[model samples]
Target chain A: MAHLDVSNVTKRYGDTVAVNDVSFSAKPGRILGLLGPNGAGKTSTIRMITYIAVPDAGTVRYDGRTVGPWSQQRMGYLPEESGLYKRLRVKEQLVYLGTLKGLSEAKAAERADYWLDRFGATDWADLKTEELSKGMQQKVQFIATLLHDPSLLIFDEPFSGLDPINAELLRDIILELRREDRTILFASHRMEQVEQLCDDICLMANGEVVLDGALRDVKQRFGKNTLILEFDGPDTFIDELAGTGRVRVNTRSAHRAELTLADGADARSVLDLALDRTDELYRYERVEPPLNEIFVDTVGEAEARRMQHESVTGTA
Target chain B: MNMSLRKIWLIVRSEYWRRVRSKAFILATLLVPFGFVLVAAAPAALGYLAEQNSSKTVAVVDQTGGQLADSLAAVSDDQLTFRPVSHPTDSVRAAVRAGTYDGYLLLPDSLLTGKGHATYYGMQGGGLTDQIQIEGRVSEVVRQQRLRAANATKGVLSILQSDVSVQNRTIQEVGTGADHTFAYTAIGYVMAFVIYFAVFVYGQYVMQGVIEEKSSRVVEIIVSSVRPFELLMGKVLGIGAMGLTQMVVWAAVVMGVLAGAAPLLALFLDPASLGVPADASSTAVAEAAGLSIPPVPYALLGWFILFFVGGFLLYASLFAAVGSAVEQQQDAQNLLLPVMTPLILPILFLAFVLESPDATTSVVLSLVPFFSPILMMLRAAITSVPVWQMLTALGLLAITFVTMIGLAGRIYRVGILSYGKTPSLREIARWATYR
Candidate 1:
């Protein structure tokens, strides 16, 4: 059974559809990346998933059953904007929040100590939350969110406002939680982080999911079949490549000329022709498209197609 | 139900401990009693010290064979030291210039028998005792001269003798004024006043508690786990416990002060030193006058606790709810008037209710839960309270108390999470009825 599933979820903030017709499911032991830029309904979708805001149309289910009051006890949500009582001691606040999540007092205390220690906040445990740095406070909030060991975790911009060291630490902790078979959904605009961490991805824009699939498959579908070659060749070979139906030279470097392959073209033929011309070629490489290139190309092409359609109808 | 109990208990425990251990709670509990002591003790001490610091000396210049001089001495107590001078006003004026006496009284020729005579004095105002003593002496002298002149009415002096005393006894519906110790009423009033202040002062603390939580955005975190009802109740109970603790300490201090007052007052103003017996009377004139000290204190205090707790809870719950409804401390003032009106109305009614506890209008006001606490306490101190009436009022007050908690909780639940919108009455009413 899926660890978490949000199906046909629709939420409207009084005529503003915040999350429209959203649906997804996540299995245990895998990270599902909810990827969207700012104002792309990421937070709204996460909120609906956590039951902070109820869906107007559909259901969010955990382990094949619909999410209800009981599911709230089993889900951990870290909101986009997190806050804690500044005057409270770090340990006390964590323990209080842990207990609020239905942990027994002893259990809450034990978990608080363990998590605070893990986050390197043991010394700051005695200090007031406000006295700590923002990164430190974020650590405390993260601990509070996960102290009860919920099966499903939703984090909105979890790596925001962190030094590299702390960000790496959070990354490691998230991976560790994934290893423990916890289903995770994180929303971020950082494509590199999502590419590195997520097995499944959902991209949203304008309150609707634009593209979502297994991260590998989606990248393959949007992959640009282009080869970046560095060779001591001349501009006449670029003309020869362009003569072959769909191959075009995109740029000329000081040491090389790069060719972009269009439909029904093989990179090896272009490479062979380049080699035939210059056996003194210093480097030859075929680079699979990076996730950033794929994301920009996919979103850019979609926007261009939308604009073209709008212009023909004289609406753009 | 279990979850609700668990959540409420969690909230209560946190609130209870947080407030109980707070420095403000500790200070308020310890400081207010000494404050009451100062208010009760300062005046009497000042009065006694003023009396001790000044002694009046009146010089009598009796130009009529020393008759007026001897009469002046007869009326003089230790407070008024009288001296007889042999010379006329000129010699007395010279003595007055020397500061030997505060002033002097002169007896002119043919002073007795209501004849034309005038006595001149210098200082004006604030010499009532001095003036009265001098006048009494002249009257005595004149009476003797009249008795000597008219021997036909020897029995006429008996008819002229009159002494007035008014006896006060306290009584009530269930207990007589004499049976109830005035000390009990004092104790009750002192406690009742503490409750009154606690509700007003600490109830504001509860309000500020909600406002703080709301402004801090902590209420969102709190209400997500524990319902706002739990939070509100927790705050009210926690603050109420703190208040009760403070009141207990204040009560102890007040009791100690009141216990010490009698000995201290007796030491400063010994009855024997004044040469006046407090209970001495030649006749039972005070009894015949039918005046008595009413058992006003205890009854008023009893009513005070009832109305005070009931009214305090009613109003404080609303205060807490209102506090949650607004996000800023400045905005809290908008909702304060309704709560404040009830609190201040009792203060205005205090004199009228205490004066006429059994008056129909006063009784009606006392039956009102808002006014009953202060008014009933005042009435209890002054007159008898009907048992059935007191119970009925308390019952109605208790009902109001429960209803307020429920009503306030509704506003709290919605308002705790609401931000930037100052909810109108209609919205709050909707919230109240929503769940």
Candidate 2:
């Protein structure tokens, strides 16, 4: 297992910065979630770490050594838009990828059969990849990533097309790898999965890292301003609280609503208002904002700022 | 950039095996040789069939008093049997019309002078060969009669009838030898065509392989473990090996068929029937009968392989770049023209090169990197190319392919990961400038 450190990395395509001064690290025994909206540079950052694309500036290091082909041998990356050779059989595809990662042919075949059996896809081994369903293809890709037993694992949207059962299976394997103390970087837009799996989280927006740290600590930093209310009456008081500019209603319905308390707003007052309007108050709790809200708040602010800057520059 | 040779080998092995095992590859590999066998054997088979159907018997009516019919009947061959009929002309015509004879020839007396036309009456139109045979026999008989009447000496007649044959031989600094110009030209043209076809076909295979990886989005995963250049080289080398395998199979099949078929063909064909001059030596008759198969130029074949490898790598790399820059096959059409132009230029100039392989223009064109594989091979086959020119052409080709591979690697590195509209040539050029 190795520590992956990407420092001050920037990647530009044409005039646009795809990954700008992005810095993060993942140590052994931890799952680092690379969270971002679409086009928020998560894939770009992962690519740099894997050495698929060279950064315009700064460095990507593994165990304090600059990453190169040697690092690549020890890193397994499952790209966001990964695919297999459509004409190649599943076992063949896995073996090719494993051998490319420096596994001997026999060992690759052995590992491939092992993984195929583990995924309960032994029957699909001789079938061409195109013959498999999208979910099955995803499972095969996951196996290919793990076949070489690399120290560092990077999976971008690994569970996107997988059914719940397969997703659960993948999650279990990832957790198992983490127990084995391998460094894992999981990049996805699914905040719930990230929250459930990641030990450390690095959130990016507008090609820059906006929030990053230990997941629990990052959530703690967001503070306990989010209120979750379950009630059984008219939700008019939720709208009334929003009108007062004391809270932001994230979602509202007649029976339940989630709201973020505005700065300097008292959670108790919001609860009292909700209690007064509802015929029955079932449950109420103040908690730190979920990663989903944090994602939106940080990326939404970054997008707004970019638009503002673009408008200003357009006029100038 | 560190490149893992092992990874590249793995890629090459996979690419080669994947295609070589495909039904399409097997069908194509086998079909080419089958088609070639069909083309090569069809005419010979037809000619043999026609020869079998050409036997005819003609009745001769002699009114010349010079006994021309007797002379013709005495020299009758199997294909044309002549019978001297003492019957009247009308009777002979009736006999021919009644199918007793294929035709009847009438020799009328005209004071022993060659002033009258001999009339042949047949049931149907005669074949050209039959007509020529009958006319030649009649003319020889009449000429002999005239020569006797004129009292010409036997030596003079022999001198007048002697056949002249000119053998073509090339005197070169290497050695003076009989020139198999026909065979060499044919083989040279075939080699050039094979290279042209292989380069275009295998180069596109490289392109298609690249595009498949890119469009399927598998390239990024592969590139993460292997450098882009190594990946590209692996693909090119792999596909090129497939092409070589197909060509070698074709060559072997064709050679095997020829080796097995030559004696069989000779059995079915008659040397005399092939129109070799009468009284010619047996060896000359055998040569004219095409029984002496020319030895294959293995050295030239060696050169052909060298140029093919160099040319394929050069064009396959460029094709891979084009494949990387496009998202679909249709988008590739526009970019293909530039790469295809150089390949086609050599073919367009093939006629000029073959017509005068020693011409300065041919020499200069053959030395050009893009044209050398084809034009140089043509020159080498048709004439003895000077050692310096061959070396220089090969050197230029080697340097060009290596440089092309490097440049193509740069473009491919960027283009494979990019998705959207197909980039303009200028934009692709800009990508090569990326760090």
Candidate 3:
């Protein structure tokens, strides 16, 4: 296992900076969630760490040495795009990929069979990739990524095409790999899975890192600003809070509502108002915001800033 | 090899074996020679069958008062039997219409004048050999009759009949090797075409292989394991090896056919009786005579392969870069014309090389790196290229191959990741120089 260190990595394509002044590092045997919306430089940063693209102004080091072909054997990457050969058999393609990643032929074949069976795809081992469904191909590709037993694994959008069951299967395998002390990093836009699976989370927007730290610590920094209210009454009280400057109601129903406290809002005063209006108040509490809300708020603010900047500068 | 090189070799090995196992490869390799055999033997067999079934019965009219008609043999070799028939021209036409005769030869009695036309009517046309035989017989009889009537001296008449033969000898001027135009031209075409065809055939393979990686998006995954350049090289060299193996199989089959089918072919064509070209190289003619067989040009063949490999690598590298620059096969179709121009140019100039292998234009073209692979093969066969020229051409070609590989590697590195739209030539060139 190896720690992946990426510092001040910047990549520019023509006039657009795809990755700008981004930095992230991972200790060995930990799952790091790389999160971003579209074109938010998540892939760019991960690509640098994987050594697929050289950073323009910073270094990507594994175990304090710069990444190169030697580092490749210790790393596995599954890019978002589907890549299995259509004409190749699942077993043969897996073995070929394993051998490419530094396994011996026999060892590759052995691991390939093992992984195929583990993924519940042994029955399709001899069948061509095209004969299998997209979900099945995704399964075989997942096996390919893990076939060489690399020290560090990187999966980009691993659950995109997977059915719920296969997604759960992948989640279990990733957790299993972590238990076996394999360092893992996966990038995705889906916040829930990241919240469920990550130990360290790095959120990016507008080619820059927006929020990154231990998952709990990042949530702690948000400081329980979300208000959850449930009561047996009409939902007018939720609307009454919507126009109020103290909170923004994210969702509402007749008897339940979730809201985020605006800056300088007092939760006690809000609770007092809710008690004043509602007869049977079943619940009223402030909780730490979910990763999804944080992600949307962060990305939305960054996008707004970019739009403002583009209008001010007259540039795209 | 080192670890990375070994990985590249794995790429090469898989690419080769994959194609080697393909049904297209097997069918092409196994069926082409048999096709050639069928094509070569079909016409000869059909002609023989037609000949055995055809027997022309020609009537002879005694319009010459037995002057020309008496000279013609009644049953001329059983191929065309001439029977004397006392019938007028109108009656002979009637017989011809009734199909009483296959044809009739009307000999006009112009008192032995050579100006009178002797008309032979036939239901159908004959082969060249048959026509020539009939023309020869008539001409010989007429000549003998004229000679007798002229009362010419025997020596004068005999000398008039003899054909003057010319012998060709080459005094070495600027080169060595055989001056047999047909043989040298044949070798030049073979060499030029092998290099041209092999380069084209396998170069596209390299391109398609790259497109495969890119379109499937395996390139990013692969680059994670090996450099983009390694993948490209592995593919280029791998596909080149496939083509080389196919060509070698074809060459072996050709040699086998040449050796094993000669006796069977000899039954159809007799070199001595049919009169092989007098000016053909004595070595080839001797073999044609079933005399002392000449040695194969192992050195020339070595040069042929050396040039073929150099050309294939250079073109294959460029083609691979083009493959990466495009997102789909349709995008690549537009890009191939420019890449194929250099390959096609030498072939277009092949005639120039054949006509004067030592001409200054030919020499310069054969020395030019882009044209050298094909044109030099032509020059080597037709004339003894200076050792310096061959080495210089090969050196320039090797240097070109290396330079192109470096450029192509850069293009492949970045272009593999850039998808969706095809880049312009300028954009692709920028990619080559990017990092």
Docking class of 3: medium
Candidate 3: list runs displaced more than 4 Å.
Answer: A230-240, A252-256, A266-283, A301-316, B36-46, B49-179, B268-296, B359-361
On lDDT, the leading prediction is 2
Residue-wise C-alpha lDDT for candidate 3, range B186-225, written one tens digit per residue: 7678778878888888888888888887888877888888
Shift of residue A301 alpha carbon in model 2, Å: 6.2
Write candidate 3's Cα lDDT for A165-215 as tens digits.
888888998999998888889887777778999999998887999999999
Error of 1 at B218 (Å): 3.0
Q: Pull out the clashing pairs in model 2.
A: none
How many residue pairs clash in all the candidates, one count each?
A: 18, 0, 0
lDDT of 2 by residue, B151-191 (tens): 99999899877866554323435533445677788778988
- The TM-scores of all predictions, comma-separated, are 0.66, 0.81, 0.81
What would the per-residue lDDT of candidate 1 be over residues B1-435, giving only the tens digit for each residue? 487677767776777777777687677667776676666556556656666655777788777778667766776766776788887677788777688877787777667646757474655453554465556656765776667667736567666545444444334468565456454545345544655676788788888888878776666555545556767877787677666666667756766655555445444543432333455331222221211122334545455656666767787898888887787867878677777888788777766765566889988987887766666666665566788878877887888889889989877876775677787666666766542
Interface RMSD of 2: 0.8
Q: Which is the winner by DockQ between candidate 1 and candidate 2? A: 2
Arrange candidates by DockQ, highest first: which order?
Answer: 2, 3, 1
User: What's the lDDT for candidate 2?
Assistant: 0.86
Model 1 misplaced stretches (Cα beyond 4 Å): A10-21, A35-57, A189-196, A203-210, A225-316, B46-200, B260-313, B335-411, B421-435
